[model samples]
Target: MGVPLLAIVAWSGTGKTTLLQQVIPLLKARGIRTGLIKHTHHQMDIDTPGKDSYLLRKAGADQVIVASHQRWALMCETPDKPLDLADLAARMDYSALDLVLVEGFKDEPVAKIALWRRGVKGEVADLLDEHVIALVSDENLTIDLPLLDINQPVKIADFIENWLR
Candidate 1:
């Protein structure tokens, strides 16, 4: 692979976003480029109402893409068909990026760092099986993997560094 990819997974409210918010800047400080793919359970609109892109889509454009100096947005019309996460990942700028840290897609067959909190009542990381190669937790996990403290961003970065190497 041209660029390394990692999936950070956790149950709702397990602090996955909080963890990423810290880790991403830390990785960037180390001269590593990072791309993020976040999955949401609700409908999303990259283009807002009254915008030209949104208006085009309202007028029955299957896909409307608006590009600017800093960023670009694409709104595709798919009322019934959902695009797979892997396909979305492929569309990213992975060739020029160093790492793609994906959030969610717990059921997808991708390498993952599973996050868990003790007494919080959630499914085991083991439920993900072999795809989950490491654990970040606040409780003692019986699984045979490298366990790191939930707040230890450096250690977590070190694990990614070592694992990618």
Candidate 2:
């Protein structure tokens, strides 16, 4: 079976990535092996123009794996079609991870922790839905779900650990 997948979701400029930068290390310190899948709408390239992998890919290589002692990366060309979340997630090495953290895909029907800032775009927590397991914010609301403090990454890590169990 696949490992448990948790999504950290928020609107642009809401600090989804920033919070994850904090939470991931804490999870590691607690001995939790983690994997991450980040979603972005814009086209991105991890290889540089003059790099050998970049040259090989430009020469019509559909996929290429660059391996070294420290690390390895697989680059696949997918210009014609966009892969869905399930397809993308299947690429992960599940045996090496206890959990997978997703950075976006807010509209997907997955268990997610929604983050909101008090004076940001929305006047209310519009992201809350049946799929949301928790809400993290600087401001507290009278909602039924668990409300976590946005500034406290340790407590958020604690909440995630509790959820895992």
How big is the positional error of residue 58 in model 2, measured in Å on the Cα after superposition? 1.2
Per-residue accuracy of model 1 over 112-137 as CA lDDT, tens digit each: 99998866667774445688889998
lDDT of 2 at 62: 97
What digit string (tens of lDDT, one per residue) describes model 2 on residues 25-87? 999999999998999988888888999999999999999998999988888888887657777
Q: In model 2, how large is the Cα lDDT of residue 146? A: 93
- Could you tell me the lDDT of residue 136 within candidate 2? 92
* TM-score leader: 2
In order of appearance, the predictions have TM-scores of: 0.90, 0.94
Question: What lDDT, from 0 to 1, does candidate 2 have?
Answer: 0.88
How far in Å is the alpha carbon of 10 misplaced in model 1? 1.1
